[model samples]
Target chain A: MLVDPRATVADMLRARGISRRGFMKFCATTASLMALAPSMTPKVAEALQKARRTSVIWLPFQECTGCKESLTRAGGPTLENLIFDAISLDYSETLMAAAGHQAEEAMKNAIRENWGNYLLLVDGSLPVDVPEYSVIGGVSNLEMLKEVAAGAKAVVAIGTCSAFGGLPAARPNPTGARPISDVVKDKPLINVPGCPPMPIAITSVLVHYLTFGTLPELDHLNRPKSFFGQTIHDRCYRRPFYERGQFAESFDDEGAKAGWCLFKVGCKGPTTYNGCATYKWNLGASWPVESGHGCLGCSEPNFWDWQGFYNPLSTTQWGGYAQIGAAAAAGAAAGAVAALAARRKQRPVGQDVQEEGK
Target chain B: MPFEALDPRDAGRLEALTATASGAHGPDPEACESVRGRVDSGNVPLLLNEVRYALERLLDDGTTHAIDVRAIPLGPGEEDRLLDALGRGELRAEFDSLGRSEVQECAYPGVWCVTHYNEAGHVAGRFLEVTFTPALLASPPEDVRTGLERLAAELAP
Candidate 1:
């Protein structure tokens, strides 16, 4: 169903049989996802109540359609999907019913109608060297991205491919693949990088823009800090094991069975920054770590070339071994000092016994 | 090895771990105590202060507020501590729409805790609403109006 451009999000929701309570619930979830304090729910609700349906154009190039699946088929009709459905999604080759010339026309009309206001969401890397490597409606990926980005309010790189030149840009890159940032330099750009980023991360970014009228604060890598601020290791439930120097040696080992840290088994949680540990996947069901697999570090740049997935992080060149070394040394030093202090405390109690033995 | 290849006991352990990590179930008390020191309790005081401030705002301007408990970086057991400190009041309510929702008043008047669960029975969102009555409990004005029209139509014949 096409959402009316003039209709606010609240209007669309109401028409869909959602009550004010449901809307409030949605705002609450959005606020939580964005890491906004609970007190900000009212503000979020107020902003959404007046938020007009934004025009969104989704362009998929050399992607596997996993990102789209992540966003659309996140379990069921989630609140995120509700917001996505309410938006005026004018052009999506995979989702839109119109095809061939009719599909191209719909995109042209959307761009013309919402010039300099529409949000451009691009997934997958672009083949700059060989434009023919990927094309849609007779337009090469590179040419299409540059053309659409010119009129966009902001360009959101939706997956690892579009954000950081994913698997296609791996070593011996064949397509001369480059991320959206390499091509769309002039537009305000944000990256939601992941091998199919978390659905909440994608929608939360959109909600922040709709509620605050600006993109959420981004890290140096141009990723939303709210979702990518902390590494997966920092929040992983198995962190206690990592701290205690316990690790799963193999996929079927006793450590793995006991839910120990996957660091030794080539887990990339320590260096990979994403919300997977905290938010989980499949609607907070379980993440890679929880499911007995190491993080593939898909969200970070050049993850595919980071040695091997099953190799321990310390063995990988991109693992930030220097930081790990310093942290390990500090932990050892602290442990030594604590042990010394405990010995001193015991010395007082055993002083007479020691003297008698002498 | 794939997840299906794991021993059933191992699979159960992973499932339990996932449930515990996702806050679907509380951590075992013995395990909780062992890791208690590792977790930070600072958010509890800050949250209590926010609750106090919200309560004052409710009294002063008659404006209700809600604090999303899930948004805060709460340490283990901190949530339970905060709830215990608030103490349960007399009123309690449960409703179902998209999923189950529970709203219960706190010891302090105008302070309520609201928890929403998804259809899968997983906690989707949690909040502390500082209002005389949560908006969820009341019939929406539109719904009330529609009900009135339906009743009138039935009487007209």
Candidate 2:
């Protein structure tokens, strides 16, 4: 169904049977996710309610379509997707039924009409060296990007490919893949990268842009600091296990079975930063580690080339050994038992002090 | 008897060298006692906003929150500012768990300032909390009930 570009977001939400309470609830959640004080919820809701429909032109280049799944999974009916859907998506070749000349014309029309105001969303990497490697309509990925980006208010690099040369730019990269930042350096660029970014994470960026009329505060990687400021290890549920020097040696060992830390199995949670711990995936469903798989460090730069997915990450730089040295030598099977035993034996700290307070 | 206006040329220098340092009138500037006490704390505004939000959440949804003050960089006087802004409520407690802990309810209802000190008595951890009761003092009611039931059974036998 075609939505009018002129309608305020509030009008659209009302049309969809969404109540103010629901919208406000989502805003509160978003504000919390953004680490904003609760007072900001009203502002978030007001911005979303009254904001004009923004024109978004999504350009997919050398890539797989995994990102779409994250969008569809979490973004289907929630306010996050509703806000995203409320935006006037003038062109997305993969999503739009229009093909051939019709598709190209839609792209041109959107650019011409909303010049300097529309947002350009790019997923996948651009085949810079070999234009012929990937093309939409006889125009190379780089050529098309340069043309469309020229008229954009901001550019959002939607996946690892567009931020850091993702899988397509992996070893012996055949397509001469390059990230969006490498190509479009002038515009206000935001990198919302992951294997396929969490849908809420992606939508929050759009909401932030609409609310403030500018990109959200970004980290060193130009990704939103609210989401990417801390590594997965920092927020991981298994972090306490890691601190105590307990680790799963293999995929199905006792440590693994008991939900010990995955560091020994090459879990990239420590170095990788993403909202997998906080937001999880698949409609607040479990992420990999919860289900017994280690983190692949999918959100990081050049993660594909980081080599062994199952190999343990070197912790010499982080002083992992020195921190947990006394217990580091013990294997997970022995460590878990020993730690539990030690915890029981350790003197109860400040019991007498607590009695006084009581 | 009468006030005569000073000549313009003399007016500029009439105050004299000593007068300039001490001011033309009133007490000498240097004689005024030096200021003391914290004027403002930088972190107060941020932490106050956090407290406000936490209060709203607690009232609206019964959500509990913990604010680690140490995790946030405190300005020179911000901690004092936060303390002043928070004021003080009914609850106050101190503990030596692991090291030492001081928990106090702030001026705002349900808001608390919890500071943990290491063995050296220096603050090792500090937090602002918003909740019906401090987390450290809370124990599970269900667990307590179960233990009580078991104890009653033991006494009966």
Most TM-score-accurate candidate: 1
Give lDDT tens digits, candidate 1, residues B3-68. 226566555555665467647465444443332223333567787898899889988999878776
Q: What does the interface RMSD come to for each candidate?
A: 6.7, 29.9
lDDT string for model 2 (B1-157, tens) is 1112433433433344235433435323222111111122224576678778878989999988876453343322345566787798887987543345677987777988776544444443356778888755654354467578989999994
Off by over 4 Å in 2: A1-4, A32-37, A315-358, B1-157
lDDT of 1 by residue, A1-358 (tens): 7667788888887887776777777787778878787778779988988888788999999999999999888866555666676578899999999999999999999999999999999999998888899999788999999899999999999999999888887766799888898888888999999999998889888888877789999877789999987777666666656556666667766777567767777887766778887677776544677666889888887777764787775433333445444444565453343234323322121133335346
RMSD values for the candidates in order, in angstroms, are 11.5, 28.1
Instruction: Give me the candidate number with maximum lDDT.
Output: 1
Chain B superposition TM-score per model: 0.74, 0.61
Residue A13 of model 2 has an lDDT of: 62
User: Which residue pairs come into collision in candidate 2?
Assistant: B41-B77, B41-B78, B42-B78, B86-B107
**Residues A1-358, model 2: lDDT tens digits:** 6777788877776566544543444555456545565556668777767777889999998879888677865523443555666688889988888999999999899999999999999999988788899987788899989999999999999989988888887766788788898888899999998998887678878777766677888876788988887777666666556656777676545575466777778787766778886566644334677545688988787777664687765555334544454554453443443334323322121232234346
Provide DockQ values for all models, in the order shown: 0.18, 0.01
